[model samples]
Target: MTKGLDLHFPHQTGFLSLTAAAVSHQFVNEAKNWTEAQSHCRSHYTDLATLYNTDDVNALTQLGSPTGSAWIGLYDDLIDSWRWSITNSSFYGPGETEFRNWNVPQEPNNAFGQELCAHMQSDGTWNDLPCASAFINFVCYGGNDQYVLINQGRTWNDAQSYCRANYIDLPSIRNATENEKVQVVANGNNVWIGLYRTRTWSDGSDSSFRHWNSSQPDNLNGQQHCTAMSFSDAGQWTDEDCATTLPFFCYIADRPTVVTLRAVVDAADELTEAEIEETILKPLREELIRNGLPNSTSLRLRKVYQTNP
Candidate 1:
């Protein structure tokens, strides 16, 4: 539904049809904290580098040959990170998705940053733990308040897959009543719930691709929430403290662009098309420059057609 940036003037509306910008990585040898590096990237180029696959990872390795690790865009979202495997928002009611019954102060402590998934205790209170390490019995909800507790053990992801294939999904404890029902299914043992969290990127990209080093993202001391790719480690990723200053990589779109805009204008019969283009291009160019488009970057209005709204 949405195209590129749309520009609006007092008597004119313009639709910016931007050809995709070819993204590239840039390495900054200067050391700075994760937040500071992000600010620098936004000010100078695009946001921090976000790798989606091995190809993208390999591309960053070719940048200015250097040593030491550098920050990328990935980071652990410590707040409001828990989510259900059944991601359909319609499955939940008002305040239902936000419901949590953790065992409190010590439960989701993320001890060493390894506890990204949650399981329910015998008492119905939840605790976060490593999803893969714990192969435990899981509960599956089959709608209409039906909960099935399977005796077989499986990892959280596996359980989610199994439940999705067989039932609705892994159980979602929306309230104490639902919790009690699911807790009863547990029959006095910890069982996997649908609650889990995942890290995010600075540019808000939702690519699930990950290339962490062995046993990385350990969230050491619970302070390592930022991610960095170690050149010495074959561009593998690891989580570090957000405040730790380090050289970082930034991405910018370097390829040329040709924009086709559909503009509507109301003007005196004497006005020329060039004048209309100038008036619209001035603000459009300013917006582009303010958003980190290089000054030397070529910008031209390929075609401006008058269309009936």
Candidate 2:
């Protein structure tokens, strides 16, 4: 019977324990505008801080414990950000979400930087307007492509609530055909659609989680487009002017690096390196996975200098 081989590894095996990527935060007390702060973060660390969950938010809050507010990574993009209220991607066909029929060059000029909501014109063209604009009618969509025009004037948010409570949501005009259908329902009066825009993270994370104070993100004075965390307010977030100078937080992550292990093993005299890999290394990897190693991790032998050492 062949006896078991006693193996020794010179370096850390990474396989014995899980290696997780750690994220840390750095607070720069120097005041800078949002853009400038973002530049500093990218230059020095990973990027402006992006809080994903309660844990992340709490960690950041505890890390800084700052005396005042600081810039984060979120910002409102006024262009190319229109989206439907019905966000289930499975409901949209190919290219459905990209549909738009703006009046072009003139419409959606974001007159006061507060034109975050979209509306349909009497001629079926689209325009951007402040969400709180009064006396605007809206259209609601039921399943099976059915649309209902509500003549009662309501703000964009109210209209959205009404539609959600009654129908599936505000109409998502996917193409000229759908746009014409909505226009026909309006019967020559302007109406609201589901299309609207919102803020996004600098790191391109699609997380929709937000921590805002009461009556926050008012887009105050139509100029507040950048986000900041107010440590004094229990780490709640608020939108501020992008040009406002404020201390900021940056996110940092450890770079992934290979942890190589020099393994010494005793095996049968006839065993080859490939045989050792198949008999010993393969089972070792399987055991590591069973213990807690991530499945995405890869293992391989770079080279074998000696058969038995």
Candidate 3:
């Protein structure tokens, strides 16, 4: 074969690792509804926080805020529509967005088709309640997986803001063991968990990651449309209404997407450096674009001289 060329995707700011991408996050301590929060984030930064992965969710828990909850970029124009809080598509994988855990594993209901908000019940089960009902206590966790349960009650939206500003998004339970950890801190009270089904991102990204606290998304009262991260059982998702305005989350993203590449070739023709860049490396970039890669990225090239084998 001809001489080889290498490709790399570096960070926009600095020389991060080859596998790193550059993303920025900024938090707004102001209290606002979901609609209001998005407007503020878009105006000041990018938009209300969006989650690329569980890591993104965990990172927000580290922020510090005084309110019990705030608002996030996640919202649904359709009753049961769901999506990620952020607009990026690279963070999703197969069967990731569809992950869900319901108390009633057999036949689940949609909060009886009532409203659009969700909260955790005692024992970590979920229920669809009105989001605008009132504020309630919520649990906040950190990147190290440490958590603090807020005794004071706040609206679901309010709770989210508090956790994000102070810690991370509502507790994201991975298994029954982790759920037990949250249950102890719950103190026998039904607290909010991070699970819901509003099938549409405010930024218009699609995600199918669902973690219901069992018997969730029931659509009870036909009014619950929003969601809360429940803590009673483990950290399951619940449904609630948008108007209820419970303590909720306000998030910022710290996502980066950096890629690095290196190549080795048998130098028989001994082509010039420019020929390698134009004939070989240039095609690689074009192919990446054809595959629908983001065009706003900054690309660079590097050269190394080695004696032929």
Using TM-score as the measure, which candidate wins?
1
Error of 3 at 98 (Å): 5.2
Between the candidate structures 1 and 3, which one is better when assessed by TM-score? Answer: 1
Decoy 1 TM-score against native: 0.73
Global lDDT of each candidate? 0.78, 0.76, 0.52
Decide which is better by TM-score, 1 or 2: 1
Candidate 2: residue pairs that collide: none
lDDT at 68, model 3: 43
lDDT of 2 by residue, 89-193 (tens): 567799999998999979876665567899999999999999998889999998798999898999998998899777778888888899999999899999999
Which candidate number maximizes lDDT?
1
Off by over 4 Å in 1: 1-21, 253-309
lDDT of 2 at 5: 30
Q: What is the lDDT ranking, best to worst?
A: 1, 2, 3
Q: After superposition, how far is residue 309 of candidate 3 from its true place, in Å?
A: 44
lDDT of 3 at 281: 48
Estimate the TM-score of every prediction: 0.73, 0.60, 0.37
